[model samples]
Target: MLVDVRNFHITGKEFERRLDEVQITVNKNSVPNDTEKPFVTSGIRVGTPSATSRGFKEPEMAKIARWMGEAARDFDGSAAQVKAEVNALCEAFPIYQ
Candidate 1:
């Protein structure tokens, strides 16, 4: 996205080359302002005792978020796309019932 890398976590020029791979979209972040970014995540852990949400296990909530972080690191300029992939994975988790 910003800098260059050759391989996954290599050093120097060679490491920058790996990023030459084509990019695709997955997701994107919008800071309509700035405050929104700070409080984007501050809600239920077990996900409330009553609500319309489903397939949500508090234990896995953070895990799902981490997935997006990992994906973001994999693709820079394409972070949005990688994030979308992570979101897709979360949806597949049989919790939204």
Candidate 2:
């Protein structure tokens, strides 16, 4: 999913920072803008290959997507809850046992 941060009133870098705070890894990407520049980084690319490899199914992936959206929409207001959920998910499916 491509999360555009323009509507969120923040830069892609800022969005990535918020995701990182919640242990969600994503990459900021350049997107078309109405400015003179051909492209401006106002979005982040979210992928679930790693999670899939870690045994995350559709339901888990959906939850992760929801968390990403929630964090993007209200990081300050939802950080603790999102972080706790992320930690719980990670604990349930640890990368290394």
Candidate 3:
């Protein structure tokens, strides 16, 4: 829930590449959950720039967002399912071809 929506401007690869910078910001503001008290995160940061640039549509973006949110919440199998779906969509769209 604390995910920096602005991070949406950052692609996932870029996010991982610059995790330290991003983490600094997240750590500065993220607080521990009172009950769970797990390592507080700013939540999943997903961007659609590459997908959209490759011709993926809004509906696909919605599915990706849902998968991301579900994965963030630790819903079992969400990540794998999303990966498969993404592969299928990419194949269908054929970005390079």
Best by the lDDT measure: 2
Report backbone clashes per prediction.
17, 0, 0
What is the Cα-based lDDT of residue 27 in candidate 3?
A: 26
User: Which should have the higher TM-score, number 1 or number 3?
Assistant: 3
Output the lDDT of residue 63, model 1. 52
Report the Cα lDDT for candidate 2.
0.82
Ten-residue region with minimum lDDT total, candidate 2: 31-40
Which candidate should be chosen as best, given TM-score against the real structure? 2
lDDT of each: 0.36, 0.82, 0.45
Instruction: Assess every candidate by TM-score.
Output: 0.30, 0.83, 0.49
Local accuracy of candidate 1 as per-residue lDDT tens digits, 23-48:
21222222223222322311112223
Cα TM-score of candidate 1? 0.30
Superposed on all Cα atoms, the candidates' RMSDs to the truth, in angstroms, are: 12.5, 2.5, 9.3
Candidate 2 Cα RMSD (Å) = 2.5
Better of 1 and 2 by TM-score: 2
